[model samples]
Target: MSDASVPKDRRFPIGLTIATLVAFVILCGLGVWQLKRLAWKQDLLARIEVLKTAPARPLATVLAGKGDASWTRVSVTCAPGQAETLPLVYGVRDGDIVWRATAICRTSAAGYGAILLDLGVVKALTGQPTPAPLALAAPTQAVGVLMAPKSLGGDRAATVARFAADKPAPYILMVESATPAPAGITPAPLPAEISNRHLEYALTWFGLAVTLLFIYAAMLWRKMRS
Candidate 1:
């Protein structure tokens, strides 16, 4: 081989090394982020467990208290015949497409002017259009968990603002049971448990980072030998 070619082949692979380092840092960062997520998820699951078994508090009382209100059990009564059905929300149940029914109870809670109520889910079978509101039979009394709306980031703030514009509380009341139960709707209670797989995800990312470093070292060794 020519003298110039020999030096070129033996020279350190600066470009490849830089690329590998960048990739390695990114993979490691992902792993660390997942670990942080694991911590947050663990705390969440514990809170859910505590809230589930606690006695149902009045909606007004729960709203007035401080700290995280999500997943809290609450009780409220809707004015007789005051249930106004809202638009259906799309959802999935047991791997099947479904629609969640909801409604607004005017002047329901003693202090709060209104509150959003999650009636239940209805299967969206093929060849069927949106189901009509179930006879506007709003439940007179409902005991359920308070859940945050599904919106994220800026959308979540906007959702809260929109719901609270007239006076409704900013949370959705997932009705577990009601006096004179709602018809044509199956109770869609919260899941018995929430899955926490962040530890597994973090391990996978860390493993990839280690694998990448080994591969890069092998390539460098081969170049030097050649």
Candidate 2:
């Protein structure tokens, strides 16, 4: 290699070295955090698998039982002659952004109030959100996996109103209707989502930290030779 192409005297400055060390420590910390997350996720998935085989109970019965009933499947009845509610949100499926049409069902049960069932989806059109009335106007029975309300960022007042209004079942249920949906609308099935990709994520962060250490060592070697 030409002298011009050679690296000049590179100083291993204490500040740079310290900064790199701090970053390396942070990266490793993140990897360890991910590993802990993996363990928690594994335990959650195991619990869900066990819950699935158990027979469906009335929404009230399941709610009465313990240990975070999120993901427990249940049967619910929609009150007749009530208007369908539409909660507009955006979602991702297979890496594509799609419109989420969540249909709300006002329950007839005595204790719990209302439930939001997935009203399938519509291909998002350019420049505007998909319109309302995307689900059936009639009432029906449903089978769904109950879940905690997804975070709605920082809109606390709106969140309280949206999630707690009309005394919704403590948990949100993404249900597939036992009855047919409105014409042109598809049945939104309950998602069996149990993610355990944290181990892979941890490995990736650990790999990057190791790679960076190697690169730092190579730089030091070149500087010493120069």
Candidate 3:
């Protein structure tokens, strides 16, 4: 087509150019934001690592006398109790069952409260039926991480009640227990703390922005030449 046949309105080209630039800028910003998020996640992972290695503190101390502070990790000895005392089951692995244990004990602050314990998975033996009352012996030490209690809204409560008959308990504990059981009862180790991908993501985004800028410039030059 002849150059004269092409619409010579400045508005169309300019509007398109501006839109493209805006899109490129937005994409670049998102990429950079992802990078920042990555860095924050990495730092958090490192902090968690330090917390894991540090000496296990009392659950009560970490709880700070608040019923809501359940995400702190702590070490404690399991008191002897009947299996029925185990709270609702959250998950199962390798044909073994796991239960949440909420232990009531007197804290140093002179108050009785409950601390969650993650009982390792237990399996039924070939001859022996599943332990009906999975009684746990007391005086056993437990090391676990504290977590916030899960919120089961009304809708979720009804849904979960179908499978888990018991009411949801407070907090979750990732524990290393000394209970005897079949293999694979031990939970997997926590992942290492570090987030290095953010830098890469940021670079990718910035590179895209640069690329878009160049493409836009080339298009503008060609249009002007024509």
Best by TM-score: 1
The order of the candidates by lDDT, greatest first, is 1, 2, 3
C-alpha lDDT of candidate 1 relative to the true structure: 0.74
Among all candidates shown, the one with the greatest lDDT: 1
What TM-score quantifies how close candidate 1 is to the native fold?
0.82
- Which residue pairs in model 1 clash with each other? none
- Candidate 3: minimum summed lDDT over ten consecutive residues — where? 151-160
Q: Candidate 2 — worst ten consecutive residues by lDDT sum?
A: 151-160
lDDT of 1 by residue, 88-139 (tens): 6656556556666676665545456777777776543312455554435557
Residue-level lDDT tens digits of model 2 in 37-138: 999988877867786586667887787677787777788877765554554555555555555556567774546677666555555421244455343453
The candidate, 1 or 2, that scores higher on lDDT is 1
* Candidate 1 residue-wise lDDT at 103: 65
Clashes of each: 0, 0, 9
Prediction 2 global C-alpha lDDT: 0.64
Each model's TM-score, in the order given? 0.82, 0.69, 0.59
Evaluate residue 204 in candidate 2 and report its C-alpha lDDT on the 0 to 100 scale. 92
Report lDDT per candidate: 0.74, 0.64, 0.51
Q: Candidate 2: where are CA atoms >4 Å away?
A: 1-12, 94-98, 108-111, 122-129, 132-138, 151-165, 180-183, 192-196, 214-226
Candidate 3 residue lDDT tens string, 1-226: 7757777842248687879879897988888798778877786667576776677677556545645544356765545554434333343333534433232221232132334444444433222334343444322556666554353111223322332323223444556543432143444223222336777788888888889888888888887776
Ranking by TM-score: 1, 2, 3
